[model samples]
Target: MEHSTPYKIFLLWLLLSSLMLSGVFIVWDIGILRAILQQDITRISTIILFVFFGACVHCAWRSFYLARQALMLAYLQDELVKEGSAVQLLSLFPRGSCLAQEYLVGLYQGRDAQDKVLLSEIMAESLRGTHQVGWFIAGIVIKLGLLGTVVGFVLMLSSVSGLDKLDITDIKQLMQQMTQGMGVAMNTTLVGLISSMALGVQYLLLDRCADRLVVDGVNLGQAFMSVSFDERSGTL
Candidate 1:
């Protein structure tokens, strides 16, 4: 479907951000990319990283649609409430009650059944992607951290094996290697925690927005249904 200008802009932003982040990851590990086909840690990490990146892309797409739906619902609701037609709202329901009619009247605008279904689907997809991205990022970080810890331990143990005959120079070099390994391990954990936290917050905010949109859609539908029936009955 043709999107509004704002929706188009939002999609563009999502695409650009995904591409830029992917580029950064590739450039940062050019050497790893050169040997990406190799069956090693580098290759495995690259695969996992790309999967997480894909999840982010999916989340972005979902967010764009959800935001658009929410905006549309808000506008429609405002228009309906401004008209102040209680009967119009009541006709939207099957067997209109005071509660249903009031609910409909309070809505901003009514939407067709198809539009309501579409909005619901968009919200569901967004929630799925947001949660998936969070878990993927967290998994990547924990795996990298563990790998680093293992490497560090191996280096430290190897150094200890030669400690009895090692000169100060050798000891210093081994200690340095061990320290670097530990740093690598910690860096992975840090990356994972930061990414997960940022995305988690975004997910929650989007989910809340999506929920509101669904409620608004339902209200709108009820109002529209009542109005449609009222017109047929000549009760306007």
Candidate 2:
């Protein structure tokens, strides 16, 4: 596959985007940020959620790299078509493009039923790789949220475990304990749900791009197939 941009460029983009997102969070919801930071007793799970969110963003950007490559290659297909050489396509497919590779394989090897199966498998594998980490990220944040809920409950229960006489002091202490538990429970749940939802949307957009890339690749490969091998064998 032709590399339109280096991996380093993608890394730079991810870093900038992360910074931009963080800035937006500060402006839009600094309350949550403050809540997490101001705690004398830090919520470790909330901190971990932030780290997971960063990973999701990085993965989403990587998938976007494929989309951009697909768009560029599709646009250049026509100009390359007139050249009538598969060899010229080597640079266009970039090393990361599994979809383009399938089509290229069909161009040399027959595009029969077995080849179709092979291509389908290739596409599935590529899609799986694209999707796997995204949902895992979502799941992790959700599980963390649940874990926080359990922790909150345990803390609340423990705080009230010594309750004996029905007195104002004991009642006030119990309420304070319960309030702390509720804060932990609510805050973690809010963060988890928000993070998972945002990540899901990001992956959804990226996957759409990937689907288009596959379509474009298939179309280009079919076009490539139409050119006689005699016509296709030439130097760029």
Candidate 3:
């Protein structure tokens, strides 16, 4: 397999993130971003959106890191197949460098095929655990946006509490307050939905990349590495 196959998802992430950045610049250039900031008096919604963006970046980096590990695994698999020796495979890997080296070592140390299968699952989980926070933050982003909408409606309603009579001046003040509240509601909802969806796409890609890495590594191990199976075991 080409070494570059594992990194394709990461490259796509970079391209998509670049497009998002471009969109941000365009929004800023048009002054809409500035207007949203001014309208959101508490700035809470804006902060949430920024936090979501940071999470996306962090997850993307993690995915890229895993991709590199996959590439390393592929290289080691090629070497192991060529040399046909467990000792040679160990020599090819630097100390504590390869992601699945332990599993390979385990198989060579007399671990059975069943044990290898279990270890593969554990390794897959370990890699997947890194992205848990990113997924969680994605869900929180949407809820926070809805919270902002509620807060905005509260602000809009609060404008009429103390006034028993409506004078021209009081009515104008009320309208101004309502307008600000409405802006906050609309801005936050828009930001929240967009951020959540964008984050979702990135994470979905990362998930698929991780899965591919696990599958490729497992397949290589089954093909070239030594594994023992129980001859007495019966099929279901």
- Name the candidate that leads on TM-score: 3
Task: Give each model's clash number.
Answer: 10, 6, 0
What does candidate 1's lDDT look like per residue over 128-161, in tens digits?
4455655566566556646645655565566577
- Candidate 2 lDDT: 0.62
Model 2, 117-145: lDDT tens digits are 57745764675465767778777887777
Task: Compute the lDDT of residue 102 as modeled in candidate 2.
Answer: 50
Error of 2 at 46 (Å): 2.8
Give each model a TM-score: 0.53, 0.74, 0.87
Predicted model with the maximum lDDT: 3
Q: Judged by lDDT relative to the true structure, which candidate is superior, 1 or 2?
A: 2
Q: Could you list the CA RMSD of all candidates, in the order they appear?
A: 8.9, 5.0, 4.4
Off by over 4 Å in 2: 1-30, 36-42, 90-102, 229-236
Q: Decide which is better by TM-score, 2 or 3.
A: 3
Model 2: worst 10 consecutive residues (lDDT sum):
1-10
